[model samples]
Every structure is written in C-alpha cells, then in structure tokens.
Target: MLLPSLYFEEGFKVIGNMVNTAFGKFNLTGKTALITGAAGLLGQQHASALLEIGATVVLTDISAEALGAACTALSCESTASRILTRVMDVSRAESITTVAEEFSDRRIDILVNNAAIDPKVNGDAGIQETSRLENFPLVQWELQLAVGLTGAFLCSQVFGSAMASDGRGGVILNIASDLSVFSPDQRLYRKEGLPADLQPVKPVTYSVIKAGLVGLTRYLATYWAEQGVRANALSPGGVFNGQGDEFVTRLTSLIPLGRMAKADEYQSVVQFLCTDASAYLNGQNIVMDGGRSVW
Candidate 1:
C-alpha cells in the first residue's frame, strides 16, 4: 500500500535523525581511553576497537617488553600516532598514580579495567594436582586478587575520581568473564584416567575476581552517577586460544554456538560500552558467551 506524502515526509525525518544519532554516539574523536593489562590478547583488541573510533589509546601493562611488542603489533601508519604505551603494575597504587599524573593534562574519557592474573589450567599432571582447591597456594591467591580485583578498584579510584572531579563525565568498562554469573564446569578440565585428587580444576581465584568486578561495577555505577561517571562490566566466554583439542571439544559442547569465541569477537561491544553508543547503559553485566550460561 502507498503511504500519504505527509506521512512519508515525517517518516523520512525520523529515520534520518535516528541514523545520525546512532553514528554520532559511536564516534570517539577527541576522546582518550586507558586500558590496563594492555599487552594481553583482549587488551590489545580493546585498544584497537577504541582507536578505530578515533580515540587516543593508552596501553598499560606491567612488562615493558610485552607492552613494546603490543605497540609494535598494533601500530600502523593511520593509527600510529593514536597509540601510547606505559609500563604499569596494576597491583601497585603508586604505579597507577604515576601514569595518571603523566596524563593529567589530558582528559581520560574512558577507563578499561582489563587486568587480571588468569591462571591457565593446562592438563599437566603436576599443574592439575596443584590447582586443586585443597592444594591451592595462599601466595597465588593473594597475587591473583591483588592484580585482578584490587587493581580494578585502585584504577577506578584514581582515574574514576579524576573523571568525576573534572565534571565532564566518563565511562568505566570492567572486563569480566562468563564465569562471573555461573560456576565453572570443572568437567571441561578433566583428564582421562586421572584420579579425583589429581584432576585439574579451574582455580577459585578466577571466579572470585570476576564476580567481584561485577559487584564493583554495580557499586561504582551508583556511587558516581551524580558525578557523571558510568560503570559497567563485560562478561565474555572462553576464547579459542590454542587450548588442547580435548578441552576445546568438551567446552564447545556446552555452548549453543558449538564453538569458542574468537579473540576479536568482543571488540565491538567493547567499543559500545566505552562510547556514547551505550549512553543510557550502566551497572549491568553483559554476558557474551555463545549462550553457554543458559545451558
């Protein structure tokens, strides 16, 4: 059926406005984003996403060598000038403070708390034995929490405070995991013929750190709402990072998508959370886990 000319004109205006607003919100030209653990796989991907939208990205990691390599890998003629690297230990307040001071002259419009000590559960018999909850080391527990949970808190406190004090408003994106909302299926890590005591399991620290991030996200979302700083978390599922075939098969069977996520799959959502595209979104955990949590 043909529409009236007047209706057509009004519809066209509404459609045009929506298109313009959508594109405008995603644009990050002149904004600056700082990412902790910037040398890691997901960290580099987050930096790439923000940089693609014209944001200046500050990549921070504890290892200068690793950060250097990441910078070299991400550098291209078009975005070379937009990429900056800093050696920072998230577990240390002074380290985070130093970086904040160095960038004091510029507005940090976005903060991506992507740092974490994710203990890989390779099926090495020795590793499996040590990873058991009963055998888990206290030193390892402290280190993981220090880097993952406390580090996010400290970064939010320093840079988040700066964003609030500036009164210009900012965004905080906490990198969580699908395990945040659910317990790990330890069966995925089971080794054939391994006795119960020798079986490898997902470390306890991973869950606690991620769950803590979600809680922190909620707290900060309300704590700084009036200050114009928004906080949110992204909980991603397992990524296909060269895990053994047996483990991959078992894990993928649990996901409806029948596959693990690619390293770059979460980039777009990272962009959305860090940009005005998600302006009204706050204090929520977005799980992108191939529908695994539902199962």
Candidate 2:
C-alpha cells in the first residue's frame, strides 16, 4: 500500500471517470414513470420528483376528475410535456391491462405503487365506535385489500411485464408504512374518557395491507431478477399533514426524531431507486421512518 504514489497520480483520470459515472446514475433523462394512486397527496410528490429528474410521468388513478386536477396542478411545477394522466383502477385486472395496452409501445421505467386507504381516527372525546376492531366493517376490510394490495400486484404484473418484455429493466417502488414492520401501538390512537371498547384504534387491515406489500416487493425482486427488473419497498413514517394536534404530539413522541416526516423528504430516495443509482439494490425494504421503527 505504501508503494502507490505513482499509481495514485496515474489513476487520477480513471477515478474522475468513476466519480462522473456515479453521479450520472441518478439522471433519469429518458425514462418513463407510472405512479398508481396518482391523485393523492404522496402520488403528486412522486410525480414531481420523477419529473424533476427528467422522467416522463404517467399519473394513474381511479377518479378522472381528481386525476385531472392532480395533473393540472403538476403542470404548474413541471411542463405538460413531462406528464400524462390516466384513470386506471388497480383493483380491476382488466383496467390495469387496458392501461398497459395503451402504453404498449412505451416502456414504463418506473412504477410507484402508492395507493392505500388510510382511515382516520377521531381524536375527540366521543370517538367513533366503528374504528374499534370488534365493529370494523368487513366490507371496508375487503375494499382496503383490493385497492392497496391487489392493486399493487396487478400493476406489477401488467406494467412490470411490459418492462420485462421490453428487455429494458425497470424499477418498482412499493409504498409501505412503518407499521409494515411493526405493530401499531393502540395507545397512540386512544382518547381520554372514551369507553374502553369505543376508543378509536388503528385498524388491522392497514397493517396487513402494508406488510403484504413488503412480501410483494420481495417476490417481484426475485421473480424478475433475470429480466432486469428491480423491486423495492419504502416504509415511511408518519407524515405531517395537518393532523390533530393531540395525535401529532402522541405520534412524534414515539419517533426518536421528535417529529413527523415532511412530505417531500422521500422524493430523493424515490429518485435513487428509480434510476441507476440503486441498480444493485433489489429485494430490499428500505425504512425511512425517522428511526421510529427502531424505537
């Protein structure tokens, strides 16, 4: 090791090439990204991040009006040339297939499975009794799974297949939650003076659906490894979205960072996974929870 002064001087040019290539990994100049649940809060952020990096974004949601509004809003931040809006229900295989067919000539370089039903809990004294597990509606459970879990599966199958068949590998970013790796502390949602059985509690379905996405990520990562497809999951912590002050205080206390996540905090990681920066990353569940899951 001590005899490398000449080697170091001679290798400077080679090292420069590596440095340039490393930074260049994050450039997404010619890729196309398809985001599910693109009408929602997080979906818009995903679209913005990808578009900022020069990727063409396809925003897909079940509602035409909401999707249009999201696309319209994004137009202000990014040019209309960078975005396309489509109404596709992930719950229906046919709908996903149809959307894929429409994009048959194009390869989806990135897919963000970001749709999920995150039901809210009333922080008031008289909490809604329906939030309790004993009274949780079976219909709601089915609906949550269909859209969150099944939807991701179908999207992966359809668009993921397109990526595979095109001989151009793609990135599948599954949006999971911190709860995917841990159980919800019911105490966080509990309200004072409410009857024991009536206090609002986090539903079982939310955790189940999120955890299922991790499994899907692993499956897809391995299943399409040979075809240049990389699948990964992002388990994010609670985001500060104007939640009740009481709920925010309780949730923050649980996090070691003493705060919730900012909405745009995850966009960089989104860029990493969708580009060559994470080319070697696959079958990994990256947790970005402000150290909440650890605590």
| Candidate number achieving the greatest lDDT relative to the actual structure | 1
19, model 2: CA deviation in Å?
Answer: 3.9
TM-score of each: 0.95, 0.92
Question: Taking the tens digit of each residue's C-alpha lDDT, what string does model 1 give over 79-128?
Answer: 78899999999999999999999998988999999999989886576644
Best by TM-score: 1
Q: How would you encode candidate 2's per-residue C-alpha lDDT over 1-295 as one tens digit per residue?
A: 4867888887997999999988888888888999999999889988999998899999999899999899899999988988998899999999988988898887788999998888887745543577778888999999999999999999998888888886878899999999999999999988787778778888889999999999999999999999999999999899999988988999999899999999999999989888999999999999999999887
**Residue 245 C-alpha lDDT in model 1:** 91
